[model samples]
Target: MVDRESDTYSCECAMFEHMGILCRHALKVMVHVGVCRIPSHYILKRWSRDARDVLPDHLKCYQKDSD
Candidate 1:
């Protein structure tokens, strides 16, 4: 089963949390279930071509240092 929170989702596979990107398991479930769009928070703007664009308001200050 996939576990979902307000801004992120995970599966027992845990690859996204470990790698800072979507896991294969998550992508498979999304495609199989016809989830057409990724939740905004899950999109890493740094990976986008327009990486300089500011994160949306709800996601502001959402990132924290793991240390």
Candidate 2:
């Protein structure tokens, strides 16, 4: 069920928790209810376009290897 007040959208299948994305059922509800924007809490940073923005330089392996 799509809980707008609490911003907790869920289905019995529990796919959102495992996969970190809204399931088809939840998506359908959002569309049907005319939800224009997805809540930020439900969005995963890694899945977003700026996923790499928060990464450290070393983690991104930008440094050259020492010979």
Candidate 3:
């Protein structure tokens, strides 16, 4: 369900809450509501390309040097 006034969306799948990615149901709701852009809150930082730009000293060894 989507509430246009509050700009909130809910789905019975709970995919977003558990997996941090919006499910088809939510996407459909957004489309139906004419949402052109994804709301910032729905974008998970960990899933972004720059998510690991900064790494801890210990974990740095596991990362392949860009250069």
Candidate 4:
């Protein structure tokens, strides 16, 4: 089963309906169904692949650039 707290799943249906994306709860269900990888369509907001072109490009703080 997908962990709502740890996973990207949201439990708000209205949010999902308005956004046409899976809420955390739905994501959990999808995880339970054995979907190890989350598709681009399932994510909501600007950080997902759908928003890749729209969102600004920024380096990850956790990543260290190689010399």
Name the candidate that leads on TM-score.
3
Question: lDDT by residue for model 2 over 1-67, one digit each (tens)?
Answer: 7667897788998888999988889888888888898878889988987776676866766534412
* Model 4 whole-model lDDT (C-alpha atoms): 0.58
In candidate 3, the residue pairs with backbone N, CA or C atoms under 3 Å apart (3 or more residues apart, or in different chains) clash, namely none
How many clashes does the backbone of model 1 have?
A: 0
What does candidate 3's lDDT look like per residue over 1-67, in tens digits?
A: 7877777787999999999999999998898778999888888888887677777877868777643
What is residue 42's positional error in candidate 1, in angstroms?
1.1
Better of 1 and 2 by TM-score: 2
Overall local distance difference test of candidate 2? 0.80
Regions more than 4 Å wrong, model 1: 3-8, 52-67
What does candidate 2 score on TM?
Answer: 0.71
| 3 against 4, candidate with superior lDDT | 3
Q: Number of clashing residue pairs in every model?
A: 0, 0, 0, 4
**Against the unseen true structure, what C-alpha lDDT does each candidate score?**
0.69, 0.80, 0.84, 0.58
Candidates sorted on lDDT, descending: 3, 2, 1, 4
lDDT of 4 by residue, 1-61 (tens): 3454565455645566676756667766776778788865555566554454443346333
**Tens digit of per-residue lDDT, candidate 1, span 1-67:** 6555453457886777776788887787778866789877677777785663466767655645212
For candidate 3, the per-residue lDDT at 31 reads 88
Pairwise lDDT winner, candidates 1 and 4: 1
Clashing pairs in 2: none
- The alpha-carbon deviation from the true structure for residue 52 of candidate 2, after best TM-score superposition, in angstroms, is 1.4
